[model samples]
Target: MFQRLFITHPASVGETYFEHMRASLGTAGKLARASAACLVHAIVPGLCKTTGSTAIMALHSEIYPRRFDQPTL
Candidate 1:
């Protein structure tokens, strides 16, 4: 049950638990920064004109190649 809860999903994506944790945290940090930039852009339209969209596109590019069922060697 512990393994299923903490390990399965990460393993399915070809990462160990700690690796997955690090990756998830990094992604969250990026999203948070992007969100802040977006909020700033909303208030002052001229600044950070493409920050949000660029961040989203970069994130999509980073994630698009990952397969959920990648075989682990």
Candidate 2:
């Protein structure tokens, strides 16, 4: 059960559990920052104008090559 819940996904992605945890945390942090910046920009039109899109693009570049779009890997 533990293996199915934790180990399997990380292994499928060629990462250990710890590595996957770190990567997920990093992505979450980046998204949080982008979200905050976008919220602020909504109130002040000139502030953080490109922050959200830039962060999304960065995340996509880092994660998109991992074969995530396939039906099976």
Candidate 3:
């Protein structure tokens, strides 16, 4: 069975993510992103395998909403 963790930050979510990844990958561990939140694809064994494990090592889809207001038409 596989489990995922969801993390929401007011700011610097990317930085935090990279930090976690760096630590995890540095130790040669495994982690998965929560499906409900951002689509985080970790470096899992037999999954998306990578030569090195870093927080920002793998490319992930950032689903953050924009703060800018829409222009009136």
Candidate 4:
């Protein structure tokens, strides 16, 4: 059960459980920062210009490429 719940997806993505946890947390951190920047931008239009969108795009590229571009040998 544990393996099915925790290990399967990570293995599919070429990561161990702990490794996947670390990477997921990193992505969460960036998303949190982006959320904050968006909140700030909402309050003051001049601040954090493109910060949120840029972070999202960067994260998307980082995640998407890694998921789809790994060599299968």
Q: Could you give candidate 1's per-residue lDDT for residues 1-73 as a string of tens digits?
A: 8877888888788899999999999999999999999999999999999999999999999988884544443
**CA-lDDT, candidates in order:** 0.90, 0.89, 0.37, 0.90
Candidate 4 residue runs with Cα over 4 Å from true position? 68-73
Per-residue alpha-carbon lDDT of candidate 4 for residues 1-73, written as tens digits (9 for 90 to 100): 7777887778988899999999999999999999999999999999999999999999998988777554433
Where's the lowest-lDDT run of ten residues in candidate 1? 64-73
| Residue 39 C-alpha lDDT in model 1 | 99
**CA displacement after TM-score superposition, residue 16 of candidate 3 (Å):** 0.7
Model 1 misplacement above 4 A: 69-73
User: How well is each residue in 1-73 modelled by candidate 3, as lDDT tens digits?
Assistant: 1112333331233446557566546534323432211232343445534332433344222222422343322
Q: What is the lDDT of candidate 3?
A: 0.37
lDDT: the better of candidates 1 and 2: 1
What value does the lDDT take at residue 48 in candidate 3?
33
RMSD of 3: 15.7
Model 3 residue 13 CA deviation in Å = 13
Sort all candidates by TM-score, best to worst: 2, 1, 4, 3
Clashing pairs in 2: none
Best of the candidates, TM-score:
2
Segments in model 2 whose C-alpha atoms lie over 4 Å from true places: 69-73
User: Residue 35 in model 3: shift from native, Å?
Assistant: 31
**Residue 54 of model 1, lDDT score:** 98
Clashes of each: 0, 0, 2, 0
